[model samples]
Each structure stands twice: as C-alpha cells, then as structure tokens.
Target: MSQPPENFAASIKDFESWPENLVHQTTCLGVLKAHKTRLDVTEPKLFTQEAEDINVSFLELIESGPTFDNLEVSDDEELQQRLGEASRRGEDPKCRFIFIGAGSPQAPLKISRKMLVRVLSYYQVIPGYVDRLLEFDGRGYARKDMYSGFLSQTLLNHTPTMEVDYLGRSGRQLQLCYNLRSIGRTKRNHLAPCHKQWSFRHGAFHHQFDILKGTAVWITTTADLDLKKRIEKSTGKTGMREDRQFQTPEQCLKSSLTVHLLLCDWAYENLRVYFLWLDGTVEDEMYLLVHNRRIHEEYPQIYSLGDLEALRNLQEQTKGALQVLKGNIGVFSGLRDFYHGLGENDGFSLRDSCIGDISSFTRQIDNIIDETKRYLAQGQLIAKIIDARETIIFQHFQSQATEKTEQLTTNMQRHSLTVRIIVFLISIYLPATFASTIFSIDVFKYQDQDPISTSNASDPIKQLVSIPAIALDRWLQVTLPMTCLTFAAAGLWLWREDRKLRREYQTTPICTN
Candidate 1:
C-alpha cells in the first residue's frame, strides 16, 4: 500500500483507550494479540454466539488452554497465572495470529514446534504442500531452495503472481494477481479470491494490498521457517539504541514495516556506493599492472609483477565480500518481494514509489559476482605465466652446468698420459735404490747403462731395455737382534725423561690461543 507519512507515536498514544488485554506482553517484545478477538465498535464476540458468522469449530481456529506449553516457559504456576489472568480479563483479539518472540523478548516472531501446530489449526483449508514448506518432520540443518526460498506459494489457485522486471523509477507496469483464503461456516460464508492490480508508472486507478485501511490483522515481513533462527538472533533495534517497551502490537508491526522499507532504500543507496568503490579498486589494479612495465595485448608478461601477490590477496577478499553480498541479495530480495506481494493480495492499494530500487540492487549484485569471477581468472593466468618463466630459467641454468661438466671430463682425459709417466719414473728410482742397498753397486756408474725408455707399448715392469724397480735375485736379510736392541734403548730414554718431569716443582698452564 502507498502509505503516507505517519506520526506512529500518535496512533498508539491512546494507551488507556485500548483494550486491557489487547496484547499479552510479558517482556519487551513477547507474545501479542489476544486469543479471542472482537470488533472494537460492534463488540462482536469472536468465539461465542455473540459473534456474527461464528464457526461451530471456533476452538480449532484460536488458542484455548490454561497454559502455552508450546512456548518455552519453565514455571507451571507462573504459566497458569498468566493464562488465567488473560482469560478472566474478557478481552478479544481481532487477528487470528499470535506474535511470539520465540526465545527472547527482543527477538522477532518465531513460532515454536507447538506454536506451528496452533497456527495450522487456525486455518480450515490449507495447501497440500505445507509439509514441504515447513520441513518439521526431520531435524538438523536444512537447505534453502525451491520450497525454502523467500517466495511463498506464488500460485495459490493456479493464478500467477504480480511481478515485473526492473527497468527504472518509472517503468512499464503490469497487472497484479490477487487471491484470498479464509474459512467460516460451509453453508453461509462465501468469499472469492479478489484479483486486483495497478501500474504505478501509469498511475492507474486501483486498490492494492490491505494493511492500514482496516482489514489487515498484521502487516508481517517475510514469515518463513527458514528465518526462524535469524530473526530470533536479530540484535538490531528500530532506532538508535532506544527503548520500544510501550509500543502496542499494532504500533510495533507498523513501525517495523516502515523501518524495513526504509532499510531497503538505504541498502540500494549503499549498493551504489559499493559499486563506485569496486570500480576504483579495479581501476587501481589495472593501472598498477600497466604502470610497472607496459603489458601488450599481443604478448604475455613472462616476468611476474612485483605486487602480484598483494593484488591477488585483495582480489580474493573482494571475491569473498561479493559472495556475502550475493547471499544478502537473496534474503533481502525475498523481503522486497514480500512488500511488493502485498499490492496484489489485499484490497488496499499497495504500490511502492521506489519499487524500482530493488530491481536495480539485484542487477548490481549480479555484476559484482561476474566481475569477481573475471578477476580471479586473470590472477590464475598471471600465476601460470610466472611458473612458465621460472621453468625456462631453470632449464637454461641446467644446460650451462652440463656444459661445464663436459669440459672437466675432457681436461681429465688430457692429463692421463702425464699421470702414467710420473708413476713409471717413481718405479725406476725405487729399483736403483734397492740394488745399491743389496749388492753395494755404485748407482751413479750403473745408471749410465740405459736411460729408461718405457713410454711406448712395452711392459714397464719387466722390459729387457729398462731397469726394474728391484732385482729379482737380490734380497735383504734382517738383523733382528740389532733392531730389538735399538727399540730397548728408545724405551729407556722415555722412562728417564718421565721420572725427571715428576720431580719438578712447577706446573705449566697450557695456552688456548
């Protein structure tokens, strides 16, 4: 509905005028709406014959027990007292629904397992696919998809919903689809699915969703089991940390919806700000990529960018942030749909002037996702190029090392002849010295017989023209007793020295340095 500006405080100001049991509030934001409601002016009883068109099975449509064990209250006495006081007061609630905080006072409306059944009892006719919507049979984690998404039963009676693609502030509008579902006496009560729509762009004359103009019991946000925990955990209050303790249920619903709509507008504005920030960040990254050393379209950069690591991290964070935005889009989009869905469902005219803002937000969210994916792909390419260049450089160094090893092998081959010649000379000199010791022959005179020439393919060990290292017949006999006497003299000399040191008075310190 096109709701004009309202002084919400004034609407709820007649505190004493309101019914004493209008809302059953224990804490700040607890249960609201009486079990038995009646018309304020007519004073028609909802559960008794005093009520007009009362259903015989009225108990099935509303709560009627001494206590709400459905909610999580501990004390039996306290629970009974609360229920007893509410019943004795004789107040009636108009709305068929009850608002439960679910867990805490500040929490949003959350119907517990028992509360769910109570609400189900309220409706005489329900769709067959409600089980798919609730998923109450099983426990643990649940997935949000076809049945779990924000959109409820779009086609209530094979009728399409009222929706359109976003274009601008004043875009072409389409007809809305409306349907109503309620229960009364099968014989007397008769109601039709009211179908209504209007194009806000054209300013066509038509009625919209019912909220303020009397028929609406409660102007609810998205009421799905999926948001049960989320709403319960919502710590955000309506205003700047102010108290809303005195607000009636009606006031709370109206104020909360108004704030929720404003928040939708604010979210769209923030999206524009985020888009600008993203554009600047991307531009800076591109500038840095080109500034260090120009990147050509035709060729790839073989060398890695110095700040590539930092840039990749930034991109990763950006991608994560964008993912979070996408999730919010899904949630907030559902909320927006809930508001727009009102236009078609009720008799009151519901048309948001800034309905186009939600569509624009959706487009921007998609764009951010696409851009993030593209940047991640670019980062992968840069990483690949750097890896390829590293492989090339490594191969070049390996090739040079192999060439140096081959040169060392060639040098070893060239020195083989010189090494053999030195060994042969050592063999000749040893033989001459042995011959002189055994036969007492003058080596200076015998050495002139033949200069050893064993460099050719002749046996250097036993050649007739070359001298051997030792003569075959010559042998040295050991004088064993003389060698033993020499060892005994060395032992006696060491014993005499050790005795002299033991008698000395002074101890010398060893120098470490």
Candidate 2:
C-alpha cells in the first residue's frame, strides 16, 4: 500500500476493525444516520432492454457454474482451455458481496435483508444493487472495476446506473466494496440473515461507511465545475466557495466510490511505475546479449529465465489493466453524462472560486485514466521489441548449433573412411611380408649341391633351392578364423551401439517446439 499520509493511518485502521452492521449505519463528516431509514427517492429505473437480456440468460446463469462460452465474457478465451486441464471442471466464483463502508456506528444492531435494503437505500442508491452487479446478463458485469465492485453496479440498470446521478448540484454518491473475509472476523458477525442469499436474488447489503477523507484531488462533475464558475453576488464578501455545500440528500456517496477510484488510480500508477522499471531492464538485457563487455560495477540484471517469466507476467498484467480501464469508461462516462445533463438544465445558482477549480479535481481522475492507457501502450511496445530481439538471438544460436553438429558428423564419417583405408593397406601388405620372411629363413635354404666347376661358357653356375609348398587347408585354417573373428567383433560393436540409441530414443520425450 502506498503509505497514506500520517493523518489517515490511525483512522483507516480503526475503520477496518468495525463490525459490518455498525459500519454500515455509521455517520461520518458530521452527517448523522438514522436506523431503518429510507431515502424518499424512487427505485432505480430499470431498462426494458436489460430485462429482456437477462430473461434470455436467466436459464444459463442458474445452472450453477456457467462456462466462459456461455457467459457474457470479455471476448477473450474459452474457460476450459485457458484454465488448463486440471481446472477444466472449475466452478465459477459465486458472488458474495461485502458491502463495507466508513464512519462510526449510529446503531450496532443487526438487520435483516429487508432492513439492510432500507438502510443502503438511504442515499437513493439502488437496493439489492449487487444482484444486478454480479450477474453476467449478456451485458458486462465480470468487467474489472478495480476490486471496487460498484463501478459496474448501476451499469446494467440504466435508470439507477444513470440514477443517483444528482451530481447536478454538488451531488456526490459513493459505494464502498470490501472483501467479506476482511470485515467479519467471527462466524456470528457473519451469521446474520443478511449473510444468506435469496434464490436468484442479491445477498445482504453489508454497507461500510467511511470517515471524512481528503484527497489531493476532490471529485466533481463538469456541471459543478461550470456552476462554480458563474459567480452570484453573495451578501458575504469576496471569497469564492468552489467546494460549496448543496443540501440534497440523506447521504454523500463521494467517499464510497472515492475509495474504489482511489484503488484504481493507485493500481494504474503502480503499473506505470513497473513499466518504467522494466524499460531499463530490457535495454540492458539486449545490450548484454549483443555486446561483449566487462562489467566492473553493479547494474541491472542480465536476461535470464526469470526475466522471461517476469516479462510474460507483465504482459498479462498490462492486458488486464487495459481491460479494466476500458470498463471504467462506463463509470467515468456516467459522470460526464451527469455533467452534460446539468448543462442542459438552466439552474439558478452562483458561487465563488474558479469554476475550473471544482472541475480540475474531478478531471484529474479522467487524466489518470488516460495516463494509464499511454503507459500500457508503452509497455506493450517494449514487450514487442524484447520479443523480436529474443527471436533473433534464438535463431542465431540455433543456426550455429546446427552447423557444428553437421561438421562433427562429417568429421566422424571421414575418420571412419580413413580407418577402413588403413585396414585395407595392412591386409594387402601383411601377406607379402610373411612370404618374404618365410623364404629368407635359413632352415629352408639348401646350399648349391654342385659347387662352382668348370662348365660350358654359356651356362652360369646356379644354386637350386627346394621350396616347401603349404597345403590349401593349412592356409585356410590360419586365415579363416582370423577373418571371421575380425568381422564378428565389428558387427557386435555396431549392434550394441544401435541398441543403445534405440533405448535412448524410446525414453526421451518429443518436444513440440
């Protein structure tokens, strides 16, 4: 959590520890709350189109866990495939809204859903609003609203969605959302009838109220902005009240929705900061990959498997944040529409301060939304660049690896041929050497029987040496076993190697990529 200013910490913690019932009925900013009180306002306007759409989807939604294919999801993916095989049978999350609020309890009594409705409707916000908020009625409800559920609440019901939009004359409405686990510490605290759900209806409203909180930016619609500008001469002297008070209703919902938007604003800033951190990361990684350098000092991390995983995670987060911003447009648009509606009305009012002052605060939110989008775009661009660089590096290494493998294979084949040539040369020369040694042996030499004597001048004295002829059987005995043994040894080595390769191939898994 971004460290809140010192002024808010103690009070915020105090607000968090209150029981749901007390918190809902609490008064804050000096606004008093009456138990079981209902604001004298009409129920939220319901659109026929929404009714028709829900009528069509009513059957599917009631079937326990509707699938992504069946639900009105963000045109993205199939639930089964995206969730993986283990989660193929996953159940969709049931809506258990924890309508937490701020302020000190006026009454600490538990109320039934009927009574809860009466209390939450104190500000003219729709009763049983979460029913319409959670269901996917062929309209957007699963849309991200920054963990703050109310942003998408009145969306389906145009009347209330556009209802409670008194924003015309300093009209402020807010709804606060909390995790159920956070508010109710004990089973009894949660055991009220409000904890139960109605069949095909909303659960109990766990309204949480807030204390007087000041933000760097206060929210106001353009009407208030324009109204603040037109100065009406007041009996009081020159000071203008840009933050003027308009007595309109039993509640000011600004704090409720303010928390939601605040959470969203903080989340967007976090995302932007993350991207800024990553910008330098990719730059350093790509440099290291392509350049040879001696890093004599500490610096950002080099690329690794973790970096890839982080990149993937960042991409997913960026995409999610983008979807959230898109959905937020509805809430922001509601504010804009309210402002325009105010302009359409010719109201009689005058105030101090630049009309721009009120608007400046509200408009700050709109700018934050815009800034989120730009940062997401920049993150996306950087992600793409990293992907391209990764691809280039992979291909470069792969090509080199392939060349080395081919070269080694060629060298092996050449060595095998050279060995065979040496063996052939030995085979041809061995028999010749054996014959010469046998013939030169003195045991086989016989002295010339006839000594050199007076003989005819035409004939030279000759020495006759008897040569022993070896039998074909003896030669076959000596050579056949040797040749057979050499051939058998070569075949055995090859067979063993082939078997080993076969076993390895069977054991290894085939990679798809």
Best by the lDDT measure: 2
- Candidate 1 RMSD to the real structure: 25.2
Give the alpha-carbon lDDT of every model: 0.31, 0.34
lDDT of 2 by residue, 1-513 (tens): 123223223322343122222222324522222121212111121111222121110001111332211222111122223222212323211111112211111111121223223223322332333333222122211223323233212111122222211111112223322211011112244532212111111111222221111111111111011111221121012323322221211111232233334333433444544555556655665565545243675543334455445445444443444454444444444444443333243331211222333254357657765775676578568758767765655554565556776998799679867866776655655655555555566654433233332233235432122222343344455555655665566667657866886897689774322
Off by over 4 Å in 2: 1-264, 292-362, 414-467, 471-473, 477-513
TM-score of 1: 0.28
Candidate 2 lDDT: 0.34
Q: For candidate 1, write residues 363-481 as lDDT tens digits.
A: 54445445534544544444454444334444544554556668976885567556556645544455455545645555422332334453532675555555433433233222233
lDDT for residue 376 in candidate 2, whole number 0-100: 52
Error (Å) of candidate 1 at residue 426 is 20
Measured against the true structure, the TM-scores of the candidates, in listed sequence, are 0.28, 0.40
